[model samples]
Target: MATPRPFSRFEFLIAWRYLRARRAEGGVSVMTWISLIGIALGVMALIATLAVRAGFRAEFVDTILGANAHTTVYMAPQRIENEFTDDVYVVPGRFSDYEEIAARLAEVPGVTRTAAVVKGQVMASANDASNVAEVFGISRADLEAMPRIVDPATSYGELDRFDEGIAIGAGIARELGVGVGDRIRLIAPEGARTAFGVTPRVNAYEVTYVFSAGRYDIDRTRIYMPLAEAQSYFNREGVVDEIEVFVTDPERVDEWSFPLLAVAGEGAQVWNWRDASGSFLAALDMEDDVMFVILSVLVLIASMNITSGLIMLVKNKGRDIGILRTMGLTEGSVLRVFFLCGAFTGIIGTLAGVFLGVLLALNVENIMAALNALTGGGAWQPEVRGIYRLPAELRAYDILRAVGLSLALSFIVTIFPARRAARMNPVEALRYE
Candidate 1:
């Protein structure tokens, strides 16, 4: 027996004929056009929404991770120290153990770098102007490990000029009307209440570096100082408030966190970036869920259009069905023909949408800028949104999922119509036509 050729020219011809017929009627029927449009629109919406969501996630995550370390170790709230009791839950002095733990953690696989950090809420005053800001103390050497604050060419003359220098947020700088080389006074609440009154000590330092993290909170109220200065000013010695850790694999922070915590022993606790920004992360997750659910409805509606269009096509092609059935085509083959037709519509629409979506995602920044220009909104900078530009990371999994969903919907929509066409009696269909 001769081997059957794998590619069936007949099936290809049949499919092509149907497709050409769809194009030649000056376009398909109103219903078919509606289905095609529906599919196109559905796909476009899915791609665009997912792309935007991805952009938002990346922007926010980068901003946060850049502003802080990938993970932090702090005294458990229950174990806060007496000195920091007023403003922060101070943990008992564990500086020695902290250093030891940090050393061990640094040895851990995937752990990049760890540094001691001190943080406090303080009132910053320059001359007569005062503003409340969160002050973070970090080692000057560690600052290099952090994301660059300002352009390398821009000298932080203010930060570099003094030994006990400070870096303030751009917003804070603007509010103070003070720049680098200006002296500022910092007041922190001490745990001790003086005999005369509650005395909050004030320490004066010069503003040195100004950083803009592009986050409203950070850019507005954050200040950075040398860890030693912070420890001295905050009256914390042989004890640091937190240990910030940078990790090589941020996504798998938990993998290193648990083991490192064990090495750090009972006094210290670990927090990943997600834990530090739980509320924001939750909001992002919720937004993604809501957007996906909402956009998926559009695909569902498009699927309905597929159903309606296929049903109509089945009715209109009754005579053709009858002839095909009479010509010895099996019911299964007949069903496959209609299924292929519906599947083709979905596949074409999905491909077109994917192309358009990727193109838009890649150039969303340009598109936004163009729109902003058209609207005369120079203030609509991408940086204002905390992202320099839209970031579209097209994942193969996402594309595969989308294509699979569309094809499944199309197949489901084709079922009843295909079944009806397949079951149509040759005599009845022929007689009716």
Candidate 2:
């Protein structure tokens, strides 16, 4: 008996012939073009949406991590001069046990660096300017851990001026019309004075440095001082508000936090940056989920066009399909042929969209610049919400997700038309023609 021919080049040729014949016979109809365009647009939307969300999430997280330590151990409220405390609320005080706490926390697997932090809200004034600012007290030795607050290269002048001095955010400096070598007054909250009729007290300091942390909140409202000076100013000598720890792996923050809290005892509370910015983080996640759903719907709409295009192909190729089946083509091969045709449309459209998406992502900054220039630079202002330029961060996972979803939807759309072709009776199809 003759050996059955291997389903190799010959099978591919049959598939190719079927594909080409379908195309030649009204396959590039209005419906086909619409399907191609829909798929392209869907892919583009998915890429752009995902890129923007990814960029926003990454940048926002970096900003939070950079501005604050990975974990903070603060004096528990009840322990803050003996007041009732809540799990999330820490009473502000000078933590005398900071060194011990730091040593213990440092022993934790992921701890990298630990430092004392003294934080308090203060009203700052220089000349006729005044603004509410958060004062961060940091040790000179531990300054390296707070790189976001001070860039060594641009901030040497500021760092050198730190003796009994303070670094104000650049925005605060601009608002106050003061820079290095300027003086500013600071007012802190003192205990209620029953004897003095609840009077308030204020302190003064010199603004010896100015730095920009690139975040509006930090640059506009944060100030830093030498740890000792801050302690003295707040009248809490040899004490600190909390111990801030930097971890090698940010993902393990909670893993280290619980143990640190246990070691810190009830006197202190351990907090990660996630707690500090929980609302902002939740909003970011919600926005990303919403955008993904919206973009996926766009892709689904695009797949509908694929369905229409395939149905048109099936109708146009009725006679050819009948002839092929009469020539001994199996129903499975008929299905495979149409499926290949639909898949080709999806592949080409997806590739084109990917090319365009990647191009746009790479040049997004430039494109924003051009638009800003065209709009007289108003669009580049930070006064508006979010950052100045449109940020696009394309990740392999996001690309894979978009491609997989698009292709899967395309395949689903091909099924009905493919089955229709497969189920056609050769005699009936030929008799109709």
lDDT per residue for candidate 2 within 381-415, as digits (tens), equals 75454343467899998888888888888888888
Q: What is the C-alpha lDDT of each candidate?
A: 0.73, 0.76
lDDT score for residue 137 of model 1: 81
CA lDDT, candidate 2, residue 219: 78
What's the TM-score of each model vs. the native? 0.82, 0.86
What is candidate 2's CA lDDT for residue 423? 98
Where is the poorest 10-residue window by lDDT in model 1?
153-162
Off by over 4 Å in 1: 1-7, 21-28, 76-101, 126-129, 148-164, 191-198, 370-390
Candidate 2 whole-model C-alpha lDDT, 0 to 1: 0.76
**Residue pairs with backbone atoms closer than 3 Å in model 1 (clashes):** 80-90, 81-90, 81-91, 158-208, 159-208
Error of 2 at 24 (Å): 8.3
Tens digit per residue, CA lDDT, model 1, 1-433: 4533433566556654665555434333666667767877777777777877777787778778777889887666453445654554633544545677677777877888989888889998875788899988887777766673653442255445435588887778877888877878888887335788767888777787777775766767888888878777777766687788888888777787787777777767888887777787788889878877787788878878767777777776788888988887778777777777777777787787778767777787787778777988663554366554555666666666666777778678878887888898989999956
